[model samples]
Structure formats: structure tokens, C-alpha cells
Target chain A: MKLLEYQAKQRFAAAGIPVPPGRLARTPEEAAAAARELGRIAVKAQVPIGGRGKAGGIAVVDTPEEAQREAARILAMDIRGYPVRSVWCETGLSIDAELYLGITLDRDRRRLVIIFSAAGGMEIEQVAEEAPERIAKLWPDPFAGPQPFEIRRLAFAGLKHAPELHDRVPKLVSSLVGLTSRLYEVATSLDALTCEINPLVLTPEGNLVAADGKLEIDENADSRHKDIAEELARDETGDDGRSGDDPFEVEARKRGLTYVHLDGDIGCIGNGAGLTMNTLDLVKQHGGEPADFLDIGGGANAERVHNALEMVLLDPKVRGVFINIFGGITRGDEVARGIIAARDELHITKPLVVRMTGTMEEEGRKLLEEAGIVPAKTATGAAETIVQLTRAGSA
Target chain B: MSVLVDRSSRVLIQGITGREGSFHTAQMRAFGTNIVAGVSPGKGGTDQEGVPIFDTVADAVAATGADVSGIFVPPAFAADAIMESAAAGIELTVCITELIPVQDMIRAREFVIRSGHQLLGANCPGIVTPGQCKVGIIPNHINTPGPVGIVGRSGTLTYEVIQGLGQGGMGQTTSVGIGGDPVMGLSFPDVLQRFADDSETRAVVLIGEIGGSDEENAAAWIRGTGFDKPVVAFISGRTAPPGKRMGHAGAIISGNTGSAQSKLDALTAAGADIADTIEDVVRLTAVRLGTQPR
Candidate 1:
């Protein structure tokens, strides 16, 4: 799950990483109150995605009135696809320099890579592409954590380009080492796949503060951090990310099924993730756009299939559904039974062309034929059938 | 003559009494896998049907002389399960558990490497030697003993290709699922090398999804090593949007990398025949192997 800046700060503060004192404001009145408490403030949009600043979702205000006005503007604005439900009101930092520090999985090395760069703030990716050498990295041992010397080395390497900070290297490296250690603690403890403190703000006062924070927890390891997950879910102001998602996707999440809403009429379902994706590809290959990507997963019995059928047809745009099942642990006959039961019980009128094979597939085909549903001999043949059926039905 | 498991390989189940474990265990037994002892911690000295249950992997290994372990532990303990299998001296550990923490796998993978044992997946359908032995949960009936070898990242896509090949009258020597997690055991290169070593394996099918450098790495290995086996490759997620994970954790297009086009380009540059669909996979496999499709 991706946390908004304010939510990420909640974690950063808990981990003792310095973040400017901040409050979440759902309304302009709340923003004004926050501004009254903190003298010079920046009201930033609370959205899970980045590039919000460029999209005019952030504003600096000197007074409560200005804070209120900016907050009202940002809150009403929708950046990218995410509507700004809340704004983060926080005290402004004294200008000195911006440095980037983040930790993510280095899949090639199979280790947690800590990335540090003098080029910080929102455009770290651009900096990496242009300058490249400005970024320094360390792949720390999971058991031993980041060594002090390694972090110090990384900090200096990142600061090599900034000649102004060359004199302050001794003091800066120590602070960076401390900050990075805390970030590592947050990453390992929270099961964060992406834990970043972009624009590690260095003040004239000689302190490192996390100006902005980004934390994306590993979906696989989410069960271990139930408390954090619960806290994230409790925030109903949309940064929990469901508001940004399609209603169908949100519904799929509620139903505990893997579904991705697409812009098409062909509703595609398969037993596995790969097969589902391939089903979508095949739908397009046959000149039909896919409505959604749904994986019923292994051993998808009648009840699960019933739920999936109901869920897919919830979208009025879905003219037809193509359920491609090549059973491994998932039996073709079992899936056929589910499809038949769902179609009859729910009175589903949409076209369902099933391409069933493997593990009692003959029985599955027989059942589909008896039920008066289209039984396809091949996946491509099924895709062709579904597209033609849907197009003809619509015409 | 298969890559991992054969008829004589004794397979033990970790978390044998769990729902998935018990169900797949019955399936594996039905497929003629040598069912030995099982490990369920407190369930030691008990028997689930004919298979004996031991409290620990060490005890199970000692009793059954089991060299292969199929782990069905939950995500929380998946790493521990893999480590336990390694420490118990299992030659090949196949973990069917999904959602294992990457850090845990990083640690477990290190141990597995140091132990000199191969770990297949924390989220994968395990290895199957057709008409010989089965380790994890790939539907037993989709396969038959033949000269083709298969390796893939997705379970159902792998089954589709295997079934298609079978229907085309081309059976498989073994089908390896390296899994779809970003951090997984036994990558594409590892499985391809194993297939290269197996004499029964003729042409190989490489099934990949959008994610990581595993597919690219496989292509590089093939090019660099001068691997002689004819390779037919199929990559899914051609239309999947970036940053959105399509079911599998690894199937995401990040920034400019891990796209189907990139994987396909690399595989093509490496001289592997690329297939657009499951039907194409079978057709390409036949073309490469110089066999007439039935």
C-alpha cells in the first residue's frame, strides 16, 4: 500500500526521523487553524501519487487567510486521477540544500539498496537519468543492517558534486548516517518495499529533516503489519487509495479477488495471474477491448466463480466475459460447474464464452454445452467467439 | 533424466496438515510421487492416512530419507520453512507458499545458497517431471512424458502451454515454475541450465511476464553460454498498465523497464522464437523441434 505524505510522516515521526511538525486538514477551516499554530506553512495535497506540486496541488501561505484559501483551492483540485480530499499543513523549512535518500529492493542483487544523492526533491529520477553519478548506493546486509562506514562513504559520494557542502562534509555525513539508519529501521520494521525521504532538507541551522516522505509497504508482507495497515484503512479521506481506484477494482478488493478494471467491453477471467493477463492480450488480439482483468485463482469452485460473474457484470460496459481456465490445481469441470450455476442463478444475460482445457476438460466442455454456453476448443478460438458475440449483440 | 525430481525422489511436505498442503499432497501422491514422511511441528508421530508426520524437518529427513521438500507454510513462516528445508539437507526445496516477505526471502535465499541447496519459489507452482515425479501443485493430468522442457513465471499460463503441447502430441520432460515474485528462488537461467543438462529435454519453452531482469538475464545467459537447445518463448502482460501489479507481485512495469516489449526484444535478439498466444507456443515449439504438429 502507498501512503500519502502525511501518513508516511506519521511513520517517519514514530521512527524518530525528523519531519516538520504537521497536521492533516480535511477542510479549509482546519487548514487555517494549522496555519495559526505554525507561523510559516506549506499546504500540500494529500494524494498517494507524486508530481502533485507541479500540478498546483501545493501552496505556501504566510497567514491563516492565505492558508485557508490555498487549502480550499488544493482540496477542490484533482491531480492526475486522484481527487485531493485533504491537505497537509506543515511548518516551512529554512533554505539550505536538498538531498535525496531512499531505500528499495534491488531485485537483480536480491538485497535492499539504499540510494543517496545530492540531487534530491521530486526530480530524483530525472537527475539519475541525466547526471547518473550524482547518486550513490549501498546494498546493506539484511541481518547486519547498514554499517556506519558504508553509509558515511555513500553520503560523501552523493555530496561530491555539491562543492558548497564540501566544507560541511564532516558534520553532514554524521547526520546523514544517523538519518539513514533511522530510515532503514523504518523500512525493515514496516515491511516497506519503497521507503524514501525525498528532499532530505538540510537547514542553515545544521539539521536534516525529511521534507517529504514516501512509503510503500510490500503487499506480500502486509499481514505482519496489521496495525499500520489498519491505521491506513481508518483514514476515509481517500488516500487509502481506493477512491483513486475504479469502483470495480474497489469492489474486487472487497471481494478478495485479483481484478484490474480496464477500458473495454470484454470482461476477461482466468484461473491464474499470467493466464488472466494473456486473456486480456488475446481479447485485444481478436479486436475486442478487455473490460477488466480478473484472476479467480486456484481451485476456484462454484461459489468463487458465482461471485466473479456477479462482480464482472456489475459494470454495464462489460458486454461479454471470456473465462479461460487451464486447470492445474483448478479443475476445468469444477470451473464449468461454477459458470453454469452463476449464469442460471443470477439470470445473467451477457455472453460468456469459456475456453476450458486440462484436468477433466472434456467433462467441463460437456457441461458448458449442456448449459447452452459457448464452449471453445482453443483460447484463440474462444477470444474470436466472444468478440464476435459481443459485437453482434451490441449491433 | 529430469531436472529436479524423478520417480525415486522422496518428497516431504512442510505444513503437511494445512489445507493447501493436504490437498496438493493427495494430488502429488496420485501422480506417483514417492510420498514419504510429513512435518507439522506438533503433529509428530501421527499419520495422515499412510504418510507419517514428524514434528520437525530434521526428524522427517532422518526417518524418510527425503531429499526433496514441498513447503506449504503460510507467508509469515515461509522463509523459516525454506530455511528449515535447507538446514535439513534437502537437495531441492520447493516452497508453494505465496506472499513471503522479500527480506525474509533475502535471508532465506542466502542460507539456501550457503547450504548449497536449490530453492524453487516462495510463490510458485513447483517442479513436475511428467510421468515420473511431481513436487508442487501443477495439475497432474496436464502433462505426459516427452522430449520438451518448459519453464515459466506464471502458473496457469504454464499449464496452458503444457496442455497445448500435450494436445499437439508433444509431451514434456519437465516443467519448472520459477514463480512471479520479484525475489524468488531458481530463476530462468537456473532452470534453463538444468534443462540443458537433462538429455530427455529437447526443445524448451520459456514463459515470462513483465517484471525484473530475469527474462533478460535468461536471454543473456543463452547468448553468452551458446546454449544449443531450441527455445520457444511467450511473454504475457503486453497490454498491462505501468505501476499497477497485475495479480502477481512481479508483474508490474516500473519506469521504462520490465515491459513485455523489452523482454520480447531481448529474447528475440537472443535467437528465441517468440509466440503471441498459447496456440503459437505449441506451433513454435514444433517448428523449433522439427516435429509435425498433430
Candidate 2:
């Protein structure tokens, strides 16, 4: 979940961190109203991804009319594959100096690091690439919090031009650290996979602002976080009432087999997440749009296998079903039982392509053969079979 | 003969009352693990699958003399669980739960380090020494005890590698899934050091994915230490695009250096025997062990 710049700033403000006054707007009228409130303002496109400014998503405007015009252009444009939904109207700040502040997970050290730099408004990646020396990074004690000494050093190195902001730097750093820690708590509580805030800005008026933010709550943790679930449900689409088919698609997800419903006819079910994704890629390579991705899990018992097949069959868009299982813990024989059961129980009228490998593969194949089902030798063969079956079934 | 766990290791389950914890606990016990006790704060006096339940990990350890703990506590209480285990003098702690906050993990990690206890995962599959003790939720039926030692980041990918090895008739001595969280308790270097020193282990199968410098660090250690045993490596998520973090928090490759290709190159440069496919990995590992591929 990526929060736009204004959303992040709002969170920062809530956390007792000072941020420039800003409001988000979708239409020109809203933009005009925001500009009137802020006076001289910066109209920026609100998108989840970074590099919005370089992509012409941000523009400075003096009046409400100018702000509205810039907002209209930004909201209409698409930057970096994300469609612009709205723009942010923020008060223009006097530049005594620009500095960058951020807190992100440092995996290697197994700690949360606070990064600061005098060079602000540029991509952190670029800053790290070009002039690594300018950036001052600190790992605060999780128990003790960020020390005043560390903040002083960072301020001296990053914001050397503004000695007046030196006393305020530690407070801001401590608050940001506190906010990040709280956000981490929220993320864990919600089962979020990731939450990030970038380009935390400092103004001449001794205020700190989070210029951009992103929060990606984990779907697995959705059951625990009602707020996230409600938000997601409110933005739901398709037959499954999700924002997209990917949420319901079990084949592509981390745990269990996920099959996403795409705008295609061929349905795909495979054993592992990695193998399933590769299978989907292979299907696309073979010029077939995969209707869904389904995995039967490592231990594909009769019930799980039956359920997987039933789910795919329920999708009315599916013309053909592709069953690909790499039997390990899940023996091929067990898979065959589920497939046979689903075939009998559901009256599966669609053509089916089956591929099985691993333990008891021969037994599985024999069972399938007895049921008049021929299994494909390779993943490609199975995909091709489904494409052919869909074409033949449609014709 | 192997590292971390074996048949004699007594296992205790924290958060044993939870669905995932109880489910995997049963699975672990069925796989011949010595599950002596369970701990769920309010669920004391109740028995789960005949294992005695206690109010806390300390009480469970005191009652059963269990040295190793596998935690199934939810993320919110994970740090507390770890601290309790550490304070209880548990020798080894394997947290099967994922999505623990980075800050919580940092504090927990510091506490563990200061207390002189070893922790395995905050978001990982637990360690297993085949035919002896299995502490985590890995599918046991796919594994068989042998002379090869295995370590990996991804749980299912590790299973794939192990299955491939099993198909080729090359069983494992011990297999460790070090978890894919960025702030994990154990790293490849820590596990590799154990494998290198273990007398029963003849060879190693290292399965790594894109993300983190652990693989690179392990490669450096292997090169510098000069472990005589053959190490067959397979790096998954090779075709995975750069800048996209995968399902695991520790599985993201941010810059050019963290990709599967780069990791593969580093491993290759360090004199590791590389395998492209699962089949190839097992086949090469068998050949190196002087056992014909099945």
C-alpha cells in the first residue's frame, strides 16, 4: 500500500511531526479551493510510484487558477505505468536549506536505519549512486531510540548550511523514528508486507514533511486488520469483489496455490508458486492468455485437489483447464484421486490437460489413463494442449 | 552428526493453541520429533496431542527440560515469545511466524545476542535434521536422512531442491530453511559454518534466491575457509526482474548486484558447483557424492 505524498504528510502530522499544510484534490475545482487556502502552492500529481517530478507530475503555481490548470494536466497524465488519479496542493516553503530524511529496513544488519542528506528532492538511489559521501546514515537503538549525538553528526554532515535547524533535527529524527516504529507495528498488526516513506522534507520555517509514502498491507494478514479489509473491499471489483483478480488468484500468492482470473480462456493449475508463475509465463509465450493460476500446494491431498479443480471450473471464462503438478510430498496418485473426484462430482464439461511429475507419477498417470485422461510430458506440452483444446472447443 | 537438530532433541511449542501452531506441531510429532511440552499463556493445564501445556515457555522448559523451542505465536506477540524463551535459557529458538515488525525483531535480536541464545527465524521455516527431529512446518514425507547438508532461503524452493535430491536418490543429513525475512536470526554463513564442521556431512547443497548479501557473504566465507566437501548450488528467482521484491521480505533485489544472476556469478566465482534446474542440481550433487543419480 503506497500512500501518496499528502497522505504520508498527514500521517506525519498525526505523529506530532511538523509538515507543510497540504490537501489532496481530484478535480480542478478542488485544486482551486486548495490553492486559495494555501496561497502560493506546489501542485503535484499523487501516485504511488516515485520519480513523479522528473516525469512532469509536479509544477509550481502562484494563483488558484494556475494551480487548477496544473492539477488538470497532472491528473490527466500517466506517469511510470500508474494512472494519475489526483494531485496535491501544498503551501510553497521558503528554502533556507533542503535536507532528506528517511527510515527503512536494513535487512543485513537486522535493524531499522535512519538516513539523512543535505541534498533533497532527488532520488535516494541517484544520491547513493552519485555522491555517497553526502548521505549520513544511522542505525538507532531500538530500545534507546535515536541519540542526540547521532542527530548532531547527521545534521552537520547533511545540513551544514543551516545551523539554526540543528537543534530541531534531533527532535524531527526522533519523531520520524517513532512514527516508523509505530508504522511497523501497524504493518505487523495488519500483516502488511511493506510500508515505506521517502523524501521527508524540511522547510525554512522549521517544519518537517513526508513528501511521499507507500504502504502495502499483506493480503495474508487481511483477516487480522479490519480497516485494511474494509478499505480493500470498498475498492473491490470483478466477480470476487476484489480490486482485481490477482487478490483472489491463489496460484501466484506466497502460500498455497493461487490462480488469478485473467481475461483469457485457458485455466492453469500447477504445484509450486515458482513453477506456477513460470507455467503462466510459458502459456503467455505460447500465445495463450492464461485465464487463471492455481496451485494444489506441496501436499495436494484429495480435498485440496478437488477444491482447486472446482474453483477453476467455477470460472465461466475458462474454456479449458490445465492441471500441472510436480508431485513431491503430494504424490501423483493422490492428485489423480482429486482430479477423478472433481471430474465425477462437478461434471467437468470443459477439456482438461494434465501434467504430473514426482512421487508415484506412474501410478497417477495409470489412474488418469484408466479414466481416459492423457497426461502431457512437459509444461509446454500441457499449455499447448490447453490452447488447442480451447480453440477446438470454441470452434 | 548434523547441525541444530537430531532425534534426541526435545522440542517445545510456544503458541501451541493457535491453529497453525497446533497443526504443524502434530505434523512435527508425527515425523518422530520429541515434542515434550507446549506453551500458550492462558491455555495451561490443557494438553495438545498429549504434550503437556504450560503457562509460559519458562514453565514448559522447567517441566519438560526442553532445550529447543519452535514458536507459532502471532507477530504481535512474537518478540515476547522470543524474549521469554531466551530468558528461560532455551538453547535454540525457531520462530515459524512471519511479518514480525522490524523494530520488534531488532530489539528481540539484541536481547537474544546479549543473552547468549541462538534464534533461527522471525519469518522462516524451522530447521530439520532428517530421520531425527523436525521442528518446523516442512512436508516431512519428501525428506529422507542421508549425508548431504542443505540450507536455503525459500521454504518451497528448498522443498523443490530436496525433492529433486530425493528423486535422484541423494538424501540429506540436515536441511535448514533460514527464513526469508530481512532480519532473520540465522544467516547462510552461520548454517554453513555448522555444515562445514559436522563430521557426518559429506557434501552441501546450498539453495539461494535473489535478495540480501547473505549468499555473497557465504560464498566469501566458503572461499576463504576452504571446506573440502563439494557444494552444489542452485539460485532460484533467476528470471525474476530486478527491483521487484518477491513474497519474502528478504527476497528483494534492489540494485544490480542483488539479482539472481549476480548471486550465481559470485557463487560460481567462489568455486561452488552450480546447478540450473532442480533435476540438474540433484543429478550433479549425486555425481559429486559418488552416488549415481536415480
Best by lDDT: 1
Compared with the real two-chain complex, what DockQ does model 2 have? 0.30
DockQ leader: 1
lDDT of 1 by residue, A1-395 (tens): 88889988988998889999988999999999999999889999988888888999999999999999999999898787787888999999996988999999999988899999988885777988999999999999878899999999999899999898888889999998888999999999888989998889999988999999999988777788787678767765443364556777888888988888889999999988899999999999999999998989777887898899889999999998998888776777888889999999989888888888876788888988998986888889999999999999989
Angstrom error of the Cα, residue B245, model 2: value is 4.8
- Model 1 has fnat of 0.82
lDDT of candidates 1 onward, in order = 0.89, 0.74
Give the DockQ of candidate 1: 0.75
Candidate 1's TM-score reads 0.96
Report the C-alpha lDDT of model 1 over B1-294, residue by residue, as the tens digit: 788889989999998899888988999999999989899999899999899999999999998899999998888988998999999999999988877888888889888998999999878889899888999889888788899999999988888888899999999999999888888889999999988998879999999999788899999999999999999999999989888888887888989889999999999999999999888998989988889999
Per-model DockQ: 0.75, 0.30
What is the iRMSD in Å for candidate 2?
Answer: 4.9
For each of the candidates, the C-alpha root-mean-square deviation to the true structure, in angstroms, is 2.0, 5.3
lDDT of 2 by residue, B119-227 (tens): 9887666788888899887777778888899998766567767777886787888999887777778788899989988988998998887778888888888888886
